[model samples]
Target: MPTHHEDELDYTPTPHNVTRARTRTAHLAAAWGHPALAPDVALVTSELTTNAILHGSLRGRLIRVRLAVVDTTLRLEVSDPRAERVPHPREASPAEQFGRGLALVGALCDDWGHGPRDGVGKTVWAEWKLPG
Candidate 1:
């Protein structure tokens, strides 16, 4: 039986923190009998964290990560303190500077979306189907 509580994993926005996030996700997946969901969750986490570090205000704000499993579906959300810059899927040329994170998220997860977080910043989320 999975615990039904509002669990949240929050951490600083550092490169090493990304690995920590991955490990945490792995543990959560294993506990919920959804080890296969770890990789996709890790990928999404990486993309979101990287975006926060590169484009958002990372002075003293910590990146908030929340993971939950409900009805055989795993929902992952990464929130940062920057609402001015919203993520959008866009076309990129072969020689483009940078632009392909959200695209990868769309391809990996069963469903993904982004929205404002309490009028402060945006939370990019993705969900994966758990194995039976």
Candidate 2:
């Protein structure tokens, strides 16, 4: 089937960009008639963006957020300038405030993975099946 929706954004690698990405994801989801998916989308976006900013690219580079719906699956992709540092879900302590993002993404998403982008970076993606 043809893609039902697609959008993307490129932002500077600054801390504020995390919030910007999340907000944009919410807007896109809502506009696509999936407003209820916004909260989880925002959460996933925040985590991936923050990780990209913190671990992937922090200088002289741009991070990208791409949203797409193919068939009935919603896919979110965050690309950063470091292909070598792929993210993985790990166990976090109860009191830890860090390193739970991938875990949350794994729990909330139907599937997620990372792959090399065309250029120097990697795109981390998460997918969810939308209700019919």
Counted clashes in each candidate structure: 0, 0
lDDT of 1 by residue, 46-101 (tens): 88777766776558887788888776778888888898877888878889978988
Question: How high is each candidate's TM-score?
Answer: 0.84, 0.94
User: For candidate 2, lDDT tens digit of each residue in 1-132?
Assistant: 889999998999898989999999989998998888889999999989999999999588899999999999999999999999999788989998787889899887889999998778999999989987
For model 2, state the Cα shift of residue 114 in Å: 0.6
Question: Which residue pairs in candidate 2 collide?
Answer: none
Off by over 4 Å in 1: 1-6
lDDT of each: 0.78, 0.91
User: Model 1 lDDT vs. the true structure?
Assistant: 0.78
Evaluated at residue 39, the lDDT of candidate 1 is 77
Worst 10 residues of 1 by lDDT: 1-10
* Model 1 TM-score relative to the real fold: 0.84
